[model samples]
Target chain A: MDRGRLALSLIALAAALALPFVAGPFWTGLATQMYIFGLLALSVDLLLGHAGLFSLTHASFFAVSAYTVAILQVRYAVPTTLAAPAGILAGTLLAAVFGISVRTRGVYFILITIALGYVVWGVAHRWSSFTGGDNGVTNVPFPAIGGVGITSHTQYYYLVLAVILLCALGYRVLIRSPFGLGLRGIKASETRMQSLGYRTSAHLYAAFVLSGALASLAGVLYVYYNRFVNPVASSFPISVEAALMAIVGGSGTIIGPFLGAGVVLGLRNWVSSFFEMHHAIMGAVFIATVLWAPDGLVGIAARLRARFSRPKEPGP
Target chain B: MTQLAIEVGALAKVFGGLAAVDGVSLSVPAGERRVLIGPNGAGKTTLFHCITGTLKPTRGSVRLFGRDVTRDPEHRRTALGMGRTFQITNVFPDLTLLENMTLAIVGTDRRKWVMHRAVAAFADVRRQALEGLEAVGLAGRAAQPVKLVSYGERRQLELALALNTRPKVLFLDEPCAGLSPSERQRISKMIAGLPRDITLVMIEHDMDVALGLADRVTVLHQGRVILEGTPDEVRANAEVREVYFGHG
Candidate 1:
């Protein structure tokens, strides 16, 4: 809403619109992946950044939705309209059940989510007949509604960009709402919040379900784009990485998670080309981020902006 | 006869083997300013917690306006017209003072659940929040985060938060615990200025502030009320002097 943010957003939008035309297919594909993973991270942050809940079971919802869409589309020939909504619903229902994790806090919440994630991953991996085992459901066609079909990756890229933009706008509105402020209040002090007539646990549970639903939405987008699904989508690593992307980018802000996704996925793609142990570099990045820039890239940028701009402003 | 705003019968709170609040009974009438005073470890705060529903009593009952509410949760008690300020100044540190007030204003009402619209869009909430701040002499610091404000200001905001909940019975747990003398006077003045319709229950270590504000005083020693009377009677009691003043 500020002039600086508006200008920056317009520039980012123009670049996103032009990337498919200007860049190669590989770059466009990578950018699309960034947006998808970015959405996943954003979902994690809805709890992590605002409500002070660090969830690691988000991959369960993501993968559950992805598997649902993949199986419905590939095995049963379900249309995108039904398959997509069904995927999101399955994931969200799972979230509603998994949402009981709100009963625990701190490391216990993380451990429970990790355990729940493995349950989903285990089913996806061990249940060979239904889930296609390790290979997962494959040959899923691109999302098509009615007569209009996404015939090319480039066309799908635009669809994803539009969805993410709309989601970001909604997320912005949500964080500014009274419910959003209540989440921040809980984050600050749950005891005080309870005394203020807030049912803190219920507030947190609602946020968890909503975050899971958003992550499920991302899963739908991902399955359509990747054209397949696998147990890796449900694995613990994916959940950790989604959370890490939010942290490395800026856990609280909208653009921070996307920026983090870009850094992470971009690093992995570029590093894995030559280095066999690229994960070490990722670990180092996380450690350095935690040690020096705990607020992520957004915090660093904010500090830099303040440093440079404060000198020019008149005394308060 | 005046109605009792708060009634506690045979209340006791035990933590493991220790009874923090051992078998205490208290009744405060509507529109009375009742102050609970004692030496350290006398269970004043523990008693407040049980009455406010922050901690469940091991045995006994708490009633508000003749309605038994011992089974209710803290928020439910708050909804039932009970509000309290913490001794250690509990508040939302990251939120602006106005936002803090807004939470309190909407807390007891259904409006706290409104999610679609931004908080600022609620013009009435904003106006009420400002008025709440103004009442606590914090209107100038409305835009500042609670963390950035002085401790004295946070204490005021703490009282402001409780007041905005619109409780019929208000509890203050050492509201001026760590304030300067001037700050203490300001807070006591705010407490004194509150309408007589709002029943006040306070715990104060400062005897001057305690006696000046109380319609009646209850003296506690070792988790039991040793004496209860007017300020003059409490001050002149030989047992109070022997136990409270540490001399016969």
Candidate 2:
């Protein structure tokens, strides 16, 4: 990584680590929520930005993990830690299976993923005996590491931050790896990659599994933080929010989605405090951002910096 | 009598009602440099696609290194020591020239799945990629994004990508299409300098280029091979002269 990028990453990490100390209870809770959403947004960006796969079913995997944790802890008497891995495993496996069928290019893939999301939502909603149907799974417990339990809001906030940081680092490493290059190769030209001896489907499937696993991890954190899981967790609006965060942050950069999550979630909290129509405000912001900053906020900033910086001559 | 690098026996490909490639049979011996020349709609590109496994033959078989590769996918074919370049320049425009060649080398490498390992960590891959770029004279432009390079350079990058795979048989589709006269001469020289062990099969529109580079030339007309001989024999053939080489 270049010096500028390294500096930016360290600064962002520092800000995140310092947020809990300065913010109040309500603000801290919101910030924690944003961090979880940031993880989800980043996972979505892996598929959309890196793999060039537009998936609308990511929230399905999220809700699957959330509901898995809820059902295992509340209904089956399983501990939260064991149940968290189980949920993530289920979500990853399901996403991998769906990826096989949904790996087609263009709008077909998007539609298939959307249909898969609806199918997951329908099952969760209809299976009332296990999922509690529309009421959702409730009384989910805080995650614990052996004897050290996340009991308070502050402790839970730190826990979410730790997981987010670890996952983000893993994402960074994965995106810079050979597998990541293969995905980018697929994105650039699937035919060319195929001609170069890469099975593009295998790369896409791996990306789908990784994205699903990350989304599931976020879902597990979300359920633990909120102490509840609802059908709305798998709703289209949640998926839209994840996509919007990714797009608004600049999908080209790995950290853009997380940055976008912070800004969008912060704005939502600010707007909802004064207005009854939070959705309308968010919708307006989405429209405006797409129009004015199609490359996203990071792209806009990069453009400005480039405009003011000293120009370099073209290379030989 | 030398081992055949590629052998096509009665290959045919039909798209809906039209036969894109029809009963085409040809053999390219190992270490041979051959050219396929035909006017537009002679199925030159279609034959290249079939050989590379992009389009499966409706009948007959394609053998690479005497092994039947008719059922393999394009990637499998590439892994089986057949490399191809598109008629239109195909390169990662967003990536640097070095990165583009590195990606090709990485693809050909067996250890491509180990995530988090720096691609440059492998000294051999880096060396091979640089060597491939040097072969096409793009070594100095290594760090420049392919999009920043001129059109001729992009073509060279495409050749570098194909060469990076270290294929036994290299198939180039119109490698000199859209180059200036000087650029064409440079590419012709580069092609002529390739290792003798690497069999070169190319589609060329320019008769002078075909005559200069190819040890053997095959002319395709209406999806079938009309003539196959030495460049002099092909140039002297009455049918080839009348159907293809005649002035418009």
Candidate 3:
């Protein structure tokens, strides 16, 4: 961390802290969504960027956790304390089962996760008796403890900010850890990792489960913020969008996913205001990203910085 | 009586209808430098894979230090004191040499599972990685990524990765493959200098390095062991000259 970067980071942090006051409620709300979804993208990157696994079933965990929190809180009148943890546990358990997808690789891996995700979406969409189907479980209240409760969306935004910030800090330590490096090694070459004494499958399974747990946490936050849970939360596009967010922002870095979330969500809001084929615009953006900036906006920024920083040689 | 370091009993690996390793069996005693030399397509690497648990044999079992490990996976074999280098260089190209060595150092132990602490914080692991790199003459290039190093350096990193795991039975699959003559001598000297307590199983195409380092030689042709004897005997055998030298 250089002085320049540190100063820049502090400025960014200050801006984020002062955003709700400076900007109107709309921008605050959108920023909040960006942070929440950014966390989901970060979770996906744990496997995608590090372990070299491309899982499309992450939304299953996200929705399962969200639905659990919604139903428990809204229907059974469970407190946020129990419901949130329970939601995370439920999502993590599903991830553990889904982690078996690590047994396959390449196209087979992608296919299995897609199929698994569809099963969850199908249950949420078709199982009307318990799941409440398309309408889903609604009127979920804001999280409230014994004495303290978040009464408004603005306060909830701050809460989301605080939680994601802590998560980001923790994630920084984690990615720099030996286990994290092991994941990178596996990504570079799994066969070599195995010969080097790593059970590549087991490392991947653990990463999958951990990634799912993070997504589950995001889901709990989403449920509280949106005040509802729907089948759309578990849909395939959400999973795809999450992966895209990580890729667009930078798959391997912390700020990259959040930055990518801002790009995607902000682009949608801005473009859909007047554009009829807003999704088409998104498709084009993704295409451009893959063709020119495969490492995401973060990588592009790095290239620019390097180019500018290098001193020019004297004339021949 | 010499203790058996590795015992492959009737090992076979078949790819569809083709038996790449067709019922090959070997017994290398502890503290012996056993080299396997054979022509291309003789299933030398396949046999090495089976013995190192890279590929499972369709029949027979592999044992390490008299323990049944045929069912064990590659990582488990490494944990049970078996380590190997690939015939083709297989170091992690994206990782720094230090990180590569760090992985090999912590691989067999519980430290590899520690997720909370950054790798840089482990001073002892870093020290050991540097020392291990020094052993392979790679200490100066510790911070460099494998991709930046020359192919010869990558080969040395390959051997370093295996040695850091602290294996009792070491397998080097053409460890000197694709190197200059001087580089070949450097690697062969490294192999020959290894402690005799560690069982050495190597596959080499260079007859000079192979015979010079080997206490005994095993010759394979058409996926079967054709000769297993002392280096002098293997060099003298007319059948070997006919097959290995292609004089027949």
Candidate 4:
């Protein structure tokens, strides 16, 4: 709430609002993808950064939502409006069931979540009747809100931006609340928290359900914007991408994941044009970032600004 | 008659073939200052863990304030007014001393899950946390992170964490385990000044400190009580002198 933070937030908001006007159509399309990815990254941050859970199965939730929208629209002839909520509800229920069981053990917890992600992926691939299987569901309808259809690319871009901003605000409020502090305490030391009469498992289960719902929202947006749903959307590599984005931006901080998503997603779109080994380059960059800025880019930037702005003491 | 703060009846804990806590039974009346002393590996810590519900006993029951809490979890025991300090100091290193104590007090209040309420707005919680720190003579270092404080101060912070919960029964595990003589003396005075209404049970290896503080003493050997009586009676017992105190 300081002047500096307020100013930074306002500036970022202005940039996001102005992006469509300044960028070409192709770049505008890519930025929209980044915003969707940013929402997914923020959800992952809630678990990994705040709750001290390391997960590699969030893509299952994402895929669940995307597939629900695709299948409902294509097979069951369900309207887009109803499908969105239904998909989110499905993802939340699935996540809660998995979260309750997996949140018990330590390292094995993470492994089980990964295995669950693979299980979902296998189902999506093998069940061709409903999912369209390997080829995916294509020509999904555009979202229409209150009879206002969003068919143009610019309209879709603004829709993604609006959802991202709303979710970001929600994340901000949640993290500043008492529940957020409990999650931080859970992260710092579970044994100490338990001794203070906190049932940590219940808190973790709720967080998982909430995070899954949010990830599913992103998945719904992705299906709307692209008019397609693919098996790769729920693949392990995409889950890894979400984790890396959360880390690169800064985990617990609200804006960190969004900033991380913008940078990495932007870089991928820019470099894929000419490079054949973009994945290798991204891997190297990830290694370097981990070594040099373990706290992420925001932490590095803060340290640099502090060094120059603060008064220095003379050597004795 | 005063209520029994803790009642352990025929408690036994077995890991594989070894009996960690073998058939231990004792009772401490409300407001009594009791100490258990023995050599290393005498199952003192194991008994503490069982009473606190950290480790489930294979047999017998533990009752706190006439409620059977034998199968309860550690958190449930904590909620029922049983405060404990670990043998190893456990304070939040990254958080300030005030924040560490505040967490305990807030957690104990059962309002920690109120997501929208700001912690700073809770004036009563802040006041109680500060009072707990002051009780341990840590008021001056309240703003400093616990990691920045000395080892002795960190130990005091651990005690402060327990006190903020306002428990009816306090279990101090080696309250002076690694303290310097001066630090040990200060902690001794602190413990001696606690409200008489709070039942105190502690495990101590320092015989001199235990004798000075405890109204009654129990000596354990290899997982069983060898002697139990008033401090004077325990000191006079022949078997305790030969087997534990190394004198006859």
The fnat scores of all predictions, in order, read 0.79, 0.68, 0.85, 0.54
Between candidates 3 and 4, the lDDT winner: 3
lDDT string for model 4 (B21-109, tens) is: 89999999999999998878889999998998778899989999999999898888988999988898877777788778778887766
TM-score of chain B of 2: 0.96
TM-score of the second chain, each candidate in turn, equals 0.98, 0.96, 0.99, 0.96
- Residue B169 shift from truth in candidate 1, angstroms: 0.8
lDDT of 4 by residue, A225-256 (tens): 88899899889888888888888887777778
Question: Which portions of model 4 show Cα errors greater than 4 Å?
Answer: none
Worst 10-residue lDDT window for candidate 1 chain A reads: A306-315
Worst 10 residues of 3 chain A by lDDT: A188-197
Using TM-score as the measure, name the better of candidate 2 and candidate 3. Answer: 3
Lowest summed-lDDT stretch of 10 residues in model 3 chain B?
A: B17-26
Residue A10 error for model 3, in Å? Answer: 1.4
In candidate 2, stretches whose alpha carbon ends up further than 4 angstroms from where it belongs are A2-4, A274-276, A311-316
lDDT of each: 0.94, 0.87, 0.94, 0.85
lDDT of 1 by residue, A1-316 (tens): 8999899999999999999999999999999999999999999999999999999999999999999999999889999999999999999999999999999999999889889999999999999999999999899899999989999999999999999999999998889888899999999988888898998899899999999999999999999999999999999989988999999999889999999999999999999999999989889999999999999999999999999888676679
* True lDDT of residue A70, candidate 1: 94
